[model samples]
Target: MAKHGFKAIEALDITYVLPTYARARVAFVKGKGARLQDTQGRDYIDFGSGIGVASLGHSHKALQKALKKSAKTLIHTSNLYYIEPQAKLAARLVEYYKRGDEGKPNTQKSDKSKWRVFFGNSGAEANECAIKIARKYGQKDGRYKIITLDSSFHGRTIATLKATGQDKFHKHFAPFPDGFVRAKDLSDIPNKLDSETAAVFIELVQGEGGINALDKKQVQHLAKILKKQNILLMVDEVQSGIYRSGEIFASKVYGIEPDVITMAKGLAGGVPIGACMTRLIDVFESGDHGSTFGGNFLSTNAGLAVLKTLEKMRKDRTLESTTKYFHTKLDSVLERYPAVFSKRVGLGLMCGLQVRSEEIFSQILSACLRHRVLVLRSGGNVLRFLPPLTITKSEIDEGFTRLLCALKELKISQTQKTAQKSKNPK
Candidate 1:
């Protein structure tokens, strides 16, 4: 049976579920190719894409077919034994990682080690493995510290929350795990580094941190410094990996080869799959760590389907063309509403509008929902847009139109409020 409408919320046991999120009242019942339908049958253009999870868009035929076929044959077996889809998917991901890496210099020890994959259930779990690997490798040297940047988000687990480097997320979660050194000031990060540092984890694109993309030269310089000190350069690509940034990995855009790269968001279309690859793949010896359902047959099958579909998309230049068109439209929107949104940031489909104020942000979001255009906020002030890579150009135009309509409404509403206050003269 389907969940009832918002009007019946009091009668339902909605409170039984943890109040971790302030979710909307409307419950989505169906979706298809960048469009979603609520239980009441209202249509919404899904600009959020479930926070970049639904990479193939909703109800993609290819993903559904793969899942169905896998269900009929083999859903899962214990990780105690090897699985065919699991091995195939890992091999494919390793190949994708090496796509543009050909012809590069191979003098470094990391190049000889090559990259290998470890599967997990989510981005957090993948990162957890990364932390363990870093600690294990550095244990003999007494280097256990993991450094993360301010205004960055890693995940929601206790250790990840400690590694988040945002004070707001740390509230009420006191006494976080030790060995984490948060870099509040980017310029002073080098000074903060010491012999105890094990890894410096960063996101090429800080998805929840206002869709911020660090400059390439600065990132490359930092990577060089860390390389000299033998510190692991770890990248959290959960939200920016898998051709989302006009490249297979955002790190490729910067031309930096990180020691550890973690990915999850769009890896297996909508399936829950997280992976972390390392140049030092043998860091974790047997019996050091593991998960039971990490690389089950079903999820890896989905991963294979997702990667195959991506290959086709790349051949036709679909993602690149759509992303370029979307950016052009975003430039138009910025020109139209300079007073509302200060500027635009991000690359490809992972874009953000630096909205003016929190009050205006709230009004704009409310207006968008009322008009049936669904978007998301980032870092308290950025209006984030992560529409599916498969979104049509026409849908892009329509979604931006509705977004502009919402901004216009908020502008008018605020202007009327100002005029009223001016005449009253408190």
Candidate 2:
């Protein structure tokens, strides 16, 4: 440790941090809408979008301007007082669900009720907020358990890690707080919920758990049942919201108006912003919960910019058509790799493929990076593609082309490995 204690560490010193992330070799130095460059100046076509945080893409002009403006004026302040940008962002999200485009809904009186939003720093924090509210809502009734679906992801925080349904995330952190349990299956939700249940949390599309999408009919059915029972229905749109799944939120696509919804990852473009929105009645009292840096001036400004950008995209219908074209291109690519991919799944830009084997999946991922096409992996096997919503049809085509080349390289490598094994007879 040196004097001037906490200065930023250089790349060589990154090992000083916790070994939480299995970081990639290359460090991106700069980026454009759908392109990125490493510190070595090597260019790459981006499909991962920084795991969906770069909604409008890296260093977008709007984001830069927003950041600069906020920095010049106010970057952060306490949440004890009202922040204009924070309130505006919350209003924008509420209005999004209340009214559709052009100030019209399917009918005059839909869910025009009030919604309150709480901001946080990341997806996990947003989810943690949701869990706390849910738990608090049941405190008087002695109901605190939350029901989450199998293979669903909440976040990495202690409360959220416990809320997550995957067993692998439960290890090495023994004794996760009580009140979180996993459902046996979608068909078993009704039976699994008990008097101790406070809420049912779901991801319309399980982004980290292989981008698995819940059935619309079953989801709506469950929502109805929960509503009648006065149980809260919560939707976690951390990876599939902010138009990533063709709609403002996949919850909108599912047509399920949940009592609570948590969103992040792409809310403020690349800026760190997470929010938990819920019905007015579901909101916690002032002393129940609060965040120190949540809804700060900077993040709220970024959020406002993102909402404005998303609204413009919706008006132009660019994301809709781009999403359609992306799926079509991915279809052609999948058709060519029948044996490597079991099937394709997902909606809008949140697409993924079911790999035939884990080896092929890893090989495909490594090849994509080597070929200058960035992507992500999910569920330990899926090749997840979550490009910026601003990606154009041509960009989608180009990215897919690069991905196809990587796929070829993977197949060739696998073939060579097979040959070597046969020769050695090992």
Candidate 3:
């Protein structure tokens, strides 16, 4: 690559691509494990993990082999016939869900025959499927409303966008699909629900809404209330599932089993895939819902590989040990920079540091990028960290070392700016 290689690529993207994402100024050409290499050959420790999509990290051997084998055998034959990989992957997800259900105390025992899976291409699609199931289940009683918590994010599609509780996302799209309402807080849920209410959707650990985890007791109580009312409970695990929260699903961490669970992001370890798992098997009948490329061989095979790898990690306690080590390092950083970081938020690997202000957050983000440590930003001035579940203690140490240096640089820069402002005050 030339000295101006990234600039050339950026120029091409500006010309051809939609300006939807505020992309960083670097172009990564290669990656291995938790490290990525830019066109300039500089390596960066991947703490963001492509916004929690690259669960197994980049170029994982198991995922690569599975993809290769599937590509050679069959990639897509539509959903007309039976797909072996898709069936196997669904079974694996069901197995995990069942185990999670059985491990918890006082929870309802899962009926394997009553549970089912629906495949899609993204989190939005999976959530859309869940919404359909809720509507269908409630149609007999004339119920269609789905209540969502404030600061929740579902997706960008019309229906899911309406389902998102954030007012910012509701802008620019007029007259969204009806039947979705937002609850100000957990306590407001019952007041909002009526005979028309069908389900309640939530993210146990709100990801884009500042990495905030809901109160466990409140969530459990809400689950019991919904169960007693016969209203469905849907969990959006799009960003917190697949061991990102040190558990297979964040719902398990909260000790509640939702009626509908929608997952994606890290499911296939980078391949695009989404799944909607539900306990209400009879909600959708034949010809009710279908996807053309939902259960294709390529995506499902990749999903199976990720499932196998994560299963091994779970059995060996690799996820547990790594999550503990990462949080410990995070707490050390927070303790050392109390003035910069107000507090630590979220659970396990899906965590964040709430900074002093949005300005400080932006400065720290830029400084970290300059120091070649990738991170993410969330709501409420948070520096979100969604590292790969396979990240090592050494990688954690390396990332934090650069992060501390970035913080120091930001402090120096801010001090200089303050001194300059004092000198030039009107």
Candidate 4:
């Protein structure tokens, strides 16, 4: 049943019920740190970090300990009763958010104290909660429009999908929920605001939308406009938070404190949890929103562990320093490849390279795969690189070596094509 190096039984052993994922040639059976080992006993550098979810890297000791310990003691304890871990985790997060850069005073006041936290199971659900919050916030006076940026991505839910700025996702799901508007320019956003507009949802950096970051000046001006118009400003930090962007939240990097913020990936160091935090405290009623699995004891404990790790990183200044170091190194790499990439964008470790075309990006990705370096593509023509915050300099150097080799191979292939054409003479 083995064909050449591949096993045909391995290919046809399973039913065709599962969906295909572009069908990678290799199968990884184990992973540690930033290296993944395939079934064929090959190791690959994991620069994608499971699409930016593996913040602490594969099977981190602390995260594993927390999960195992929590699983042994208790698992699910529905939302009906009090959960100490959930309460403690919430307090820790609120404390951290209020304290800002640690030891900083609680700058968010008592009136804004009306703001609260909502938990969910994924990025999309977190965004869905945000959509509900925005809609409810506007329901008081018939406001319902949410302004999302063009080329921006929120999630795949019906509401968030509608809120997504790309038309490609709107396929087959026509007649999406109304009240979502797209604005090309930050200057043109004010015209879209009215009594019916509940909030303006924005991604400080459009992670899935080619890693296009918003201009700080434009963001500040837009925030001021929203504040003056009495409209809520919601930020989707689902992919840009948790020190992935060098800062705890992209909001901090952009210098704009949104009224509402959503987060999920890398929150629990790979555990499934999504959170929506907002400055608008009194926007929801007792029965307005709920989730069965949100803030469960196990997930909450994982969240606590993640926060503890982050606290340690912040105390040692590793989070900030690592992000800066990664950014600087990636910038250097971009400078070296100016011919292949126009520029690099993004803050901290969440960086992207603007390649010549989608085909070029795919070729680069394939080349990385061949060299055992794993990276993911974003939008159409950008390669997103989100390695673990704890990745070592040696590992980074190794990854960059693989990347350089891949680029060299691509050049050789291009040269071969040119030579072949010159010899063929049409």
Candidate 5:
């Protein structure tokens, strides 16, 4: 960790107890929209978007009001009672993705049944529920193996860590679940499938896997193959859902319907809530998987508010068009610095730029911090941009100006080093 000049009390040694995060030096005390203020009142242009959780931006009034009102009314009831907010939120969510008419829905629906929701408190928990459902779905047929892509990222839980395709996350957390298999590409999946295979899980855009996106054909083909094999299709949308990818869900852009969808992060506008919404909601028994605080009154209220705001943003074209404009500006800026950045990849606001090396990324990140612009590194060598969907053109231009100035400084530093090396005859 790069040490910032903040003094710490010996009593505040909790950081040593928890795992270390690649955190910035400055401490943020307040945030609004796309701007954050540090302890010393220095302002920063936030491109991290709280790691893709603040879709409506920090401290949104809608979310705040909902949270406060719900808190005053009721916070937790242990899921024993029929919580009105939870039921209402789930109904709203189902209506958003419900197919056909109410009585004559689709093939997945039962004659007398409705879509069901299983909620949790975080992305990992959401994924854990999906994993459990998939396992049970195939437990009868002896099909338990899960096929994930080479560069896909799911979550940090034991099941999700095993589901994660990158080998780096698998270190030391050995002896993961037995039914997981990693594939180089979708074609590699066919060879790995057997009677023990249960489902295929993937990230539409591999956020931690360098922000690389699967080809539309690759995804569609995988979905087809999984359907043929009776293997469930699970899309991990924890990072890509809730308008982060311009669409409400990344699967919409890919033109595929997953059997199960896991969503979190932006679901509640920074409040902790994760959910597994699936067409096959009846696969698991009632006691197979559950959570105590999953769909409590407060979180559900916040989720409803968040969804309403996003739906409004989507209809008004404020979120999607703004994100598209910002992406275009990013591409134009990157074209002017091709030597420093080779390529950029992403969909809408969920974007990443691949730098030449980890060293370059670190240098640029340090420079961004110095200039009071906050950004995050994704998939080792790419700088991920998760700016608020509500950010304006002026904010984009200002952030880009700071970023370009940092790049220019790095370029000059490299040139000076080359000149010094020539003079020293090394």
Candidate 6:
């Protein structure tokens, strides 16, 4: 054990690891469900869920069992061979897409045979695959431009980064891959579209972009327009999929059938896996795209375990009830601290509380950390909450209790600072 707690680990990381992230001081060593324990042995209520990747929570029994079982057997093999776990996992995802299509009288029932899956290692890879499909599908017609909504975040790779609609990420990455256009809004999308338009990719709930969920009616209308024009509609469900939006996919919540859907983050309950599911399966030939580690034995089995657990939750309506309870808790918090919070944004367990300003957000975030509660920030001024799907009511209550204490402490500190400023008059 290190004598200096996280400081020793921090020193080693700073020395050896690339400094890509401005990390918090704490170093978590263990976690269970909605709670985490730091190297110092201090407990914390986890609301960030590693930015919404731990959907089934940390060290879940199902995931552990699957990992152990897969490790004892085979960890990976070439994609050339038919992997049962990978095939099963892909079929399961397609079934989920089909399940969302049920009971819609006006909509055509999803044909399982029409859809196909491509496994990858991250959301960026999945999104890249989706973009490739759109580009390839449009190549015959010379249409290659993909329209994305402003404030949207796609991924970090060169292609996916170009697909991101935010300007901040565009800086420093010069000469990005072409064929991506940004639309200001639904109205502007029509103006942005032309003969070169191949697809309109969007996140139903913009998780990293301040948790802003697009209006359902506008999205439905956009989908209709895109379909009429023979343009692909891609949905990036990396952060909002897997019951994060109270549905298997956020696209289902919006009631729009996307031509391509990309998912990662929570798909395998913390295992590194991503998937690109598309109806246009013929767009990519066998040699068009491949991943050496994609759909490996361990990852696919982990995904299967996560799917099984989530299926049970969906069947028992545990996911539905929990989502409702979470929203209710958020509503109560917003009501209690009207002045501190501007509004609540997002859907289901994927939520954000907009603060009065960025400074206030930073203060509250630091206070939350000080109070042994781990949270996240998004879109500069939003305090994002992405607790595990398995977070219980009592855990929610406890988290809120710590949050309220942080708010009170902040209030007191602000009052003192005001007094000091008045006295100093500098």
lDDT of 3 by residue, 1-426 (tens): 446699899999999999989998999988888999999999999999999999999999999999999878999999889999999999888777767433433345555446789999999999999999999999999999999988899999999999988888888997988899899888899999899999999999889899998999999999999999999999999999988887788888888879999999999988889999999988888899999989799999999999889878877889889988888888888776666777899987899999876677878989999999999988868899999888888888999999988987765356645653554453
lDDT of 5 by residue, 90-166 (tens): 78767666533232335564421355778899999998988888888898878888889897888898889999999
lDDT of 1 by residue, 1-426 (tens): 146675576335464766677877777888989999987888789999999888888999989999999989998887889899999988887777676544233444447247888999999998998888889988989999999999899998998889897899899988888999988645557987998999999988899899999888889999999999999999999999887887778888888989999999898888999998888877888888888889898899998988888767866788888988988888787766665677898877889899877878889889999888899999899999999888988888888888878776875456745654554444
- Per-residue lDDT tens digits for candidate 4, residues 43-112, read 8888888878888888788888889988899878777778788788766666666655455756765433
Note the residue pairs that clash in candidate 6.
none
**Order of the predicted models by lDDT, top scorer first:** 3, 6, 1, 2, 5, 4
Please give the TM-score that candidate 6 achieves against the real structure. 0.94
Please, what is the TM-score per model?
Answer: 0.93, 0.92, 0.94, 0.91, 0.91, 0.94
lDDT of 2 at 153: 90
What is candidate 4's TM-score against the reference? 0.91
Candidate 6 lDDT, 29-86, residue by residue in tens: 8888899988888889999999999988888999999999999999998798999999
Summing lDDT over every window of 10 consecutive residues in candidate 6, give the lowest-scoring window.
Answer: 100-109
The CA lDDT of each predicted structure is 0.84, 0.84, 0.88, 0.80, 0.81, 0.87
Q: Which stretches of candidate 4 lie over 4 Å from their true place?
A: 1-16, 101-103, 107-112, 411-426
Query: Residue 64 error for model 5, in Å?
Result: 1.0
Candidate that would win on lDDT: 3
RMSD per model, one decimal: 4.1, 4.8, 4.2, 4.5, 4.9, 4.2
Estimate candidate 2's RMSD in Å: 4.8
